[model samples]
Target: DAGVTQSPTHLIKTRGQQVTLRCSPKSGHDTVSWYQQALGQGPQFIFQYYEEEERQRGNFPDRFSGHQFPNYSSELNVNALLLGDSALYLCASSLGLADNEQFFGPGTRLTVL
Candidate 1:
């Protein structure tokens, strides 16, 4: 079975632009969560999606939003990006309701110029 997958692995953008990163959950999983890991910091939860609706959200601004598809894949979109938004965007997957160990993908490193 395929593990979680994220892309494009690396990204570069300007401070005012927008970016959309993608993720495919591990096989047999139905919940997807997005995390932001700043340099030298632990991953901070952005939001979680299950059943195609947002189930949980973190202490982030409205600029961070996400979507989940029926197939269990997901996408994270950041609008009007700021330099502070430059970080490693990680996607984690869990089966059914959360609480189990989450499986993470190699994150997408975003750099805002």
Candidate 2:
């Protein structure tokens, strides 16, 4: 079975631009979560989606948003991007929120110039 997958292996943007990243969950996974990992830093939670609704969010601003589709795939949208937003966008998928096993994708490397 395939593991989680993300699109746009790399991206370049400028301040004030917007970007959308995609992710396909692993087989049998239903929950999707987004994270931002700055260079040399651990990931910071962006938000989580379950059952087609946003179930939980982290400290990120409203500009960061996401959607979960019926197929358990997901997309992350970032508006008014800033240089600070340059990082690896990671997607994680799990069977459920309470499940400890979460499979992660090879993150999309985003750069703001």
Candidate 3:
């Protein structure tokens, strides 16, 4: 089975521009979560999607939004990017069960220039 995967491995953007990153969850999973990891900080949850709906969210601004498709793949869209938004965007997948363990993919390194 294919594990989680992300696109573009790396990205460069200017302040005020927008970027969209994509992710494909592991097979048989129904939940996808987006996380932002700063240079020296742990991953911070942005939001989670399950059943084509946002099931949980974090304290991030409205600029961060996401969507999950029927196949459980997802896309993260950030608007009005700021310098602070430059970080590693990680996509994680998990089954919607109580003992689910999230599996991460190689993140997309977003650079806000």
Candidate with the greatest TM-score versus the true structure: 2
| lDDT per residue as tens, model 2, 14-76 | 999999999999999999999999999999999999999999999999999899999989999
* C-alpha local distance difference test of each model: 0.96, 0.96, 0.93
TM-score (C-alpha) between model 3 and the true structure = 0.96
Model 3: which ten-residue window has the lowest total lDDT? 92-101
Which digits, one per residue and each the tens of the lDDT, describe model 1 over residues 1-113? Answer: 99999999999999999999999999989999999999999999999999999999999999999999999899999999999999999999999764689999999999999
Residue 25 of model 3 has an lDDT of: 91
Residue lDDT tens for model 3, 1-109: 9999999799999999999999999888889999999999999999999989998899999999999888889999999999999999999999993536999999999
Candidate 1 wrongly placed segments (more than 4 Å): none
Error of 1 at 77 (Å): 0.2
Of 2 and 3, the candidate ranking higher by TM-score: 2
Error of 1 at 108 (Å): 0.2
Cα shift from native, residue 54, model 3 (Å) = 0.7
lDDT of 2 at 50: 93
* TM agreement with the true structure for every prediction: 0.98, 0.98, 0.96
Which has the higher TM-score value, candidate number 1 or candidate number 3?
1
lDDT of 2: 0.96
